[model samples]
Target: MKDLLTTTSSIIVILFCCCVLFLGDDADQHLSEPDSEMITARNHKKFLKARHPLAKTTLFRRVQSVRLKDGVLMFVTADQNGLKEHFFIIRDKNVILVKKDAGDMPPDSIKFDADGHGGIQVTIPNTFELDPLQDLLSCRN
Candidate 1:
């Protein structure tokens, strides 16, 4: 009977140690994960202080935005004075600068036409596609 009790106690202690070790490893991994607010090279450009200081140019401000299909957002930002609009898009949580104005400048050349089902259909003339895996892995400006 004493031997059986000792074996049972040993098993219980081993199981407890395994649980604590597993939980400790999991908590450490969670702590090591990158924080969303932490600034990185990809997102550092969006912050005001990191931008280049120009004599006439101030900060770029978002003047207009259009919601497109599949959780995409088209943004139009202008210089501090709201002149010289720039176009961009946020797709799959990545901000992409529009390389060319495929359509027109006043409307940013990007046509956000209406779909029959009350959703936005975006039309871009040029190739604006990006490889999600490559973007995440590589350093791109």
Candidate 2:
């Protein structure tokens, strides 16, 4: 019985060592480098912190999408009651207040287009609001 127990313990130790050797490098790399999704989430959290320092009732409900063309970010905020939706655009690291839209209509999609003068236009569906792409970036969340 003693010999058998020793053999089993040695086998288990060998298996564990093998696993660690084979998986060690990949595990270290994964831990050291964060993926794009993690980076994006971190950036969004930072944006919220910087934009809405004193916000309690109003906070970001959804980050619709991030524009790939110009790396622009779109965020939607809702009041505590969720009765109003506030749209915001982040470009060049500046957060711009786009519009305060009604919450009755659900947002379908967002369209992005070039404005010919080195700017991009954003259009939210189900609304007739113009693209406030050039709006001031002075909103306090």
Where does candidate 2 clash, by residue pair?
A: none
- Highest lDDT: give the candidate number: 1
Kindly list the per-residue Cα lDDT of model 2 for residues 13-79, writing each as its tens digit: 9999999998998898888775534537649776555533332222233334322223334444434
Model 1 misplaced stretches (Cα beyond 4 Å)? 35-141
**Model 2 per-residue lDDT at 129:** 40
- C-alpha lDDT of all candidate models, in order: 0.48, 0.47
RMSD (Cα, Å) of candidate 1?
Answer: 18.8
